[model samples]
Target: MENSLNTLHTIAFTHRNLPVSEIGNLHIDPNDQKERLTAFQSAMNLEELMFLSTCNRVEFLFVTEDIVDHRFLHEFFNALYPKLSETQRKLFADSAEDYTGIHAVEHLFSVASSVESMVVGEREIITQVRNAFEDCRKMQLTGDTIRLVMRHTIETAKKVYTETNIARRPVSVVSLAYHKLRDLNVPLDSRILIIGAGVTNTNMSRFLRKHGFEQFHVFNRTFEKAEKLANDLNGTAHKLSDLNTFDQGFDVIITCTGAEKHIITKEIYQQLLQGETDRKIVIDIAIPQDLSPEIIAENNVTHISVEVLQEISNANLKERSKEIQHVEQIIKEALYEFDHNHKSRMVELAMRSVPEKVKEIRSNAVENVFHNELASMDSESREVVEKIMGYMEKKYMSMPMLMAKEILLKKR
Candidate 1:
């Protein structure tokens, strides 16, 4: 079991492994996430599979009997995304980075702790990891080992937060969007148009709600989701198609969607500009960008693109470098414990019959030695005799235990 556990593999196509262009192409829609996860499992016969897809990464962590290579990934992507050409499939395989043994544990911990994020110390990544873990479990793709490691990784992430100040500041792109809106001095009474109700805008709304900003008009392709977020935040909800009908102009517009194309184009921007009494601000946090770059260049509309937020996040990073160092040290300690615990679990799993095997062997030896001898002793003497026998049983078990360990070591 330890041998198999030690062979656990984590293959990731992350911001570090792939360029932004490739990463953007890999974004799985929230609706299709589960289907893709299931597809991966069925296609690969994965025993223990975990899929984590985010804006900057697409990672697959799984356990298999034999070690995996790039060829496996080539087939994996070929099955996972059939639209990809052979060249694209091979590119996906070639670009993926794998971590095995203890490095897998370390890498997982780093990711959960937000150490591997494009913008370090963004706490939302922990939530993203948690959601991925839950999704895997819901899909029945995880085995005991994966469950244990994922739970431990989440715990380690919490420890990083509690022990360090790395996540003390608002560092995520969504949170930065909220801060950017605040900095632009949009009045509290300003009508806020929240375009697209995906994770980014959801997070942005939550951040703004925390700061007691509530003048919102939530819109999404799915009106029900928009209504849900709006009702929760004490705002109004509208279908995205109703933008042209919105008689009221907004002082701030935040466009964050999972769509690949621009959701707010020049025409939409023109419609948004109608009836505006004050200067407007727009925060576009989507990958392809919900607002067109041409709209961003328009006069009188202040635009905050994801790139601008990233620059702001980078500027704030200097103040948290010390905390980052502290977190790396914490991750090292957590990795040591994870490896040790995993080894212990593997041993227990592998030697599950050892105790019973020893018990049977010891009982046979004791019966031969004391079956007749103890029958003639008094009751009190019998009790004392059994105590002595128990001590001898433990002593004898040690020899077998050592031999068993040798066998296990040889297997390793």
Candidate 2:
């Protein structure tokens, strides 16, 4: 159950590790995610690392040049969260999991496939994973190991989607939210207000549009994003600040935002409820949440958070039990691929290690030659020398990675 199960170093700190609220402390601001990654790279000096932070989880997939133990992980977290409380620190220190080698590949593949989602088969996670991968690419943080694992992860996950019904029914958070809104029995032509113009809201709008609901008012912190989404949805845009002042009341409201504080607090709810009499439903898809609990207590309004949605979705997810075994089979096959590739790569590295080291020393010697022999030379000549060294280094490291069968046959 604990992540320490693996001896090789691949780590994950997720909802399984701590409560979401506690996980909040580990939350890196989206803007600061790259900075946090840079800090991890500098501190760990790892062989390879991939960082994934989502509303439901924060995962760190890494490899060390040498085998490491629990203490190495504890110290790693300590540096990452120096300000954590004793309890918070223990949650992270004691709970972080590392699944060494192929196990790491399996875990990542599971995540990419939505086996780890609160809602079993949420599709949005696919986008989130891709975004995380692209971010690492932008920061130039992805290494050869991470690239192979992520590519396999995507492939394995997509196979699950195509080959199974696990993703069927009301399995995603967005679709579940839409189901809840429909169950409210509000009129089809009811006035609707959507707060925040992110992905969830976009999906909600498209769902509503398909259902023939055209009366929509969109609001966001930035008027432009809201206006753009509004235009896309065939609706009017309003400033998020207009929540308190808007004279007309919508029959239903949906809000999902990144704001740390409740955008629809009790006070704001009262103002929104001011002008006219109408029953309302609020679908809050935001993490850190958008609507306060008190909004649910108001007589005419229903507030549905992600937790609420999960509870409702659980009943529908039961049918997916049969599909899990198939998913497991897919994972098993991916693990096989990962193992085969990893062993071949390892053997290649092992057989060539001494030669590689000699090459490394030669590289150092060449660098010295550059400094001493080429230093006094013309700029163009020195550039040519550097280019030649680059070419040789590439050639030396470019030997084919081989599986045991291939290596054995070649030996024969």
Candidate 3:
């Protein structure tokens, strides 16, 4: 059987190497992953695979014996993303950062621990990694090796967060947006219009609500989702279609959605303003911002965007960098533990057939070799002999595995 651990590799296109805009090009919708990733994995000859996509990063973690060089990456993107133009494909292949074996393990640990995030110490990446692994595992794209790695990765992340101060003074985009709005001295009762009740907006709205901001009107593509967030904020819900007719003036707009284009066009913004010239706060945390650029330039709108938040995050990272050394030390220990555990699991698998073989040997002794002797034994004596042999059989099944594990663990 293949030792998938030794062949582990990761091809990552993240904010580190590419701009956030370019990283967005690599996103695969969850609805399309089952078919797309399955075929991609088979085409790439990966034994096991997991795909993780976040706002700022997209990574392919897989196990295969083939070396991951420029040629391998060219073929990788060609097989997985054939729709891309030749130049786009070559750009991705050239830009990808690849890691193999132990380096791959360390990278995953860093990712789950949030040390590798664009905003260092943001805790959301751990949940993203976990959900991504579970999704790929459900699609049958991952097997034992990836499973083991993720398990250790999560454990290591938990330890890093628990033992270190990396996550202190939370500085996520949501919090940054809240701080910006507060600095504007916007009244708590100011009308808040929220567009798209996705995770980012949900968190942002909830943070505002917690800070005593009560007036909220949530509009989403799905009325039900809109209602859900509206109820949480004790506000009103409107379908996204109602945005044009939403005549109620707003003091602040918190918008983040998965739309490819601007959800708030120039016309929509004009109608939303209701002829009021007073300045408004608009927080567009979406990757491809929900608010149109024209609206920001032409109107009395103070816009807080993902790009602005990234600038703040970059500064926050310097404060968080003090904890990176401690986090990396934990990750180093986790890598060693994973290695030992992996070898022990391999030994356990290698010894799995021992029990059946021992059983077969005992059967041969009692049923074949000792058949005539057992036929002559009295009933009481036969029972005693059977008990002794059964006891011996149990020992024979367990002893070798125990001894082997002990020896292997000691060597580690």
Candidate 4:
């Protein structure tokens, strides 16, 4: 099992090498994940697996003994994304970055800490990591290895965020969008048209509401979802279909959805404009943006896309970069701690049967070895003898484990 621990691996396709646009192509739909990941794990003979996807990254963390060379990667992507063309499969396989053993552990800590994120200071990645683990765990796709690693990973991330200046100021896409909106001098009474009820849209809408912008109309494919977000913001809810018929003008449209193509088409924009010639604000933070490119090219719209936010993120990252050394120090300490903890757990597992074994020995001695002698003794003498032996047995059972743990701690 210790050798198996060294086989832990991570395969990452992130914004560092791949464009965010291409990253979306790797996103396995939630409905397809269980079947896809399970089959892939079985085929690869993986001991455990966890899949994590974000706007700009897709990662596969697993424990397997097979060397993840080019051939392995080709086979990996081939089995996992069978629908992809040979060319596409090869492209992904070639672009993938992999790490093994302790390096893989370090990569996860960096990711959850947000230091490896496209937006380095954003703390949302921590929650994203935790949620991803939970989702994978629910599918029974993970085991003790991932569970132990994630526990340490989350702890290191929290320490990094709290102890250092990494997440000092808000630099998330949502916060950046809000800052852009604030700079635009948009009024609180401006009609805010929210175009999805997903996590991104919910956060943006609630953020806007918290900043005293009240006028909102949320639209989602699921009316109940839109209604839920609407209720939270003291706003109105509408089905996504109603967007075509919405005659009410919107000064700002904030849209983020799971649509493969543009949710807000050119015609939808024209109808939504209500003949107003004034400039409009559209925060299209969705990957493969919710706003149509034609709308941005043709209409008088101030579009805030993910790419635009990334440019700002790069500049803000310099300030956060100063704290990387500090964060790395914490991660190093955590890595050492995890080593010690893992060894201690191994000791506990190895000695788990000691008490039962000791009890069996005591039973044999009392019933078989000393049965004749005890039969010749009085009841009071026998009772006292049994109590003394039980005391010794208990101490004998606990001594080895306690001594082992003490030695391990001393070595640490």
- lDDT of each prediction vs. the true structure? 0.78, 0.74, 0.88, 0.89
Task: Tell me the spans in candidate 4 whose CA falls farther than 4 Å from its real position.
Answer: 265-279, 292-300, 360-396, 399-412
Output the worst ten-in-a-row residue range by lDDT, candidate 3: 1-10
Off by over 4 Å in 2: 1-10, 13-21, 65-78, 239-245, 275-278, 297-300, 344-405, 408-412
For model 2, how does the per-residue alpha-carbon lDDT over 1-412 read when each residue is reduced to its tens digit? 1122242356666665565545555666566667877787778776556677666577777666645566776667776776777676667768777677667778888888888777777778877887888888788777766776778788888999999888876457778888777787778888888998877788888889889898999999889989999998789999999987876667888887766667887777777777565667878777667788676776676777766775765676577767888999999988877666655555664556645765776767767744587667898987887788767666655544334447644543
For candidate 2, the per-residue lDDT at 232 reads: 84
Q: Give the TM-score of candidate 4.
A: 0.86
Q: Write the per-residue lDDT of candidate 4 for residues 39-142, one digit (tens) a residue.
A: 99999899999999887889999988888899898889778887778888878888898988878999999999998988887888999899999999999999
Cα lDDT, model 3, residue 92? 87
Worst 10 residues of 1 by lDDT: 403-412
The root-mean-square deviation over C-alpha atoms between each candidate and the true structure, in angstroms, is 4.9, 7.5, 2.8, 3.1
Clashes of each: 0, 2, 0, 0
Ranking by lDDT: 4, 3, 1, 2
Per-model TM-score, in order, reads 0.79, 0.77, 0.88, 0.86
Q: After superposition, how far is residue 399 of candidate 2 from its true place, in Å?
A: 8.8
Tens-digit per-residue lDDT, 303-368, candidate 1: 787667766766776776767889989988887777666765665565567667768876776688
What C-alpha lDDT does candidate 4 achieve relative to the native structure? 0.89
Looking at model 1, residue 135 earns an lDDT score of 81
